[model samples]
Target: MTSVWVGERVRLRAKEPDDWEAFHSFEEDSDAVRNGWRLHPPSSAAYAKKRTAEEAEQRPDLDDPDLVIATRDGNVPVGSIGAHHSDRDHGTFAYGISVGTPYHRKGYASEAIVLLLRYMFFERRFQKAEAWVYSSNDASLALHRRLGFVEEGRRRRSHYANGRYDDEVLFGMTIEEFTALHT
Candidate 1:
């Protein structure tokens, strides 16, 4: 498998349909299911085929890119990262570590994001990358902050989740800033 970006403990690679079961497992996990706005309940398989087809047809040229994170040990995919162009020269991303219940808090998310940002800035030549975080997801907000994604904007009551209105925080990082930070 080709590596997208290699880091200390993990590498990013292209997602394959063979990963469907694993991806589904992660998405179905209790925490993941609750946090993922668009992801339905674990037992629902309604859109699996369609989602797989969509991801399979995605072209890397104009964003809508997705990558899987695999640990160095056995190359098992632990998480996923994805980005799409919101507009020319500007892009937005959503990422999550579905590293199974056993692998949480093991730095997989951080590694996946670091590789994803490197690819977005250096490979795809994007000007900026942004992520949307739900207001209550403190772990994700903290992760974004650590990665230099500053809080650029927020939409109050933008999303309705868990029977409540939730705020959405937008975090962004520029190509220049990413390069400088890495260097």
Candidate 2:
């Protein structure tokens, strides 16, 4: 499937080479770092490699193809959403997402997420979509809850960030749930 998903206010677009600067900026932001679970710097070369592999997949789960969440009008990059550990054979996926520091509370991440989930379940035939949110991330927790994700489990002290361990909250939404929520 194509990597362009249009939403009311945001669009999840394919990661183009031109988007590197915006993506790098989002990754390097100090505030984003504090809330983000993964702290490592993203390399431009690695991003390109991932894109190449994604395009080469014969049966690509569009959700596994990392995309930039940009405004629908000017297409300004604001965030990212990607599925990793995607087990298409089992129809399951685990995803990660973020919106830039300046774009928080604007409903961009939520819009991007719902579009991606729709692509995952309806187009890619995914049975379920899952996420691991850092327990301290109130915004993400609330976003998942508002998007109809069910809290599945918790791994206590599983993530180390900001010189302390944080719990990882597991959330999942099955295809039936996705259909019910959307339809």
Give candidate 2 misplaced runs (Cα > 4 Å): 1-4, 41-63
Per-residue lDDT of 124 in model 1: 60
Supply the TM-score for candidate 2.
0.84
Q: Whole-model Cα lDDT per candidate?
A: 0.70, 0.81
- Local accuracy of candidate 1 as per-residue lDDT tens digits, 42-96: 4545466557557766665435566777786777878777765546534544444
Among all candidates shown, the one with the greatest lDDT: 2
Query: How displaced is residue 176 in candidate 2, in Å?
Result: 1.3
Q: Ten-residue segment with the worst summed lDDT in candidate 1?
A: 89-98
Question: TM-scores of all models?
Answer: 0.80, 0.84
Judged by whole-model lDDT over C-alpha atoms, candidate 2 comes out at 0.81
lDDT of 2 by residue, 34-146 (tens): 67766775567677556545543435345477777899889998988888888968999988998889899998998888888888887888899999998989999999999
Best by TM-score: 2
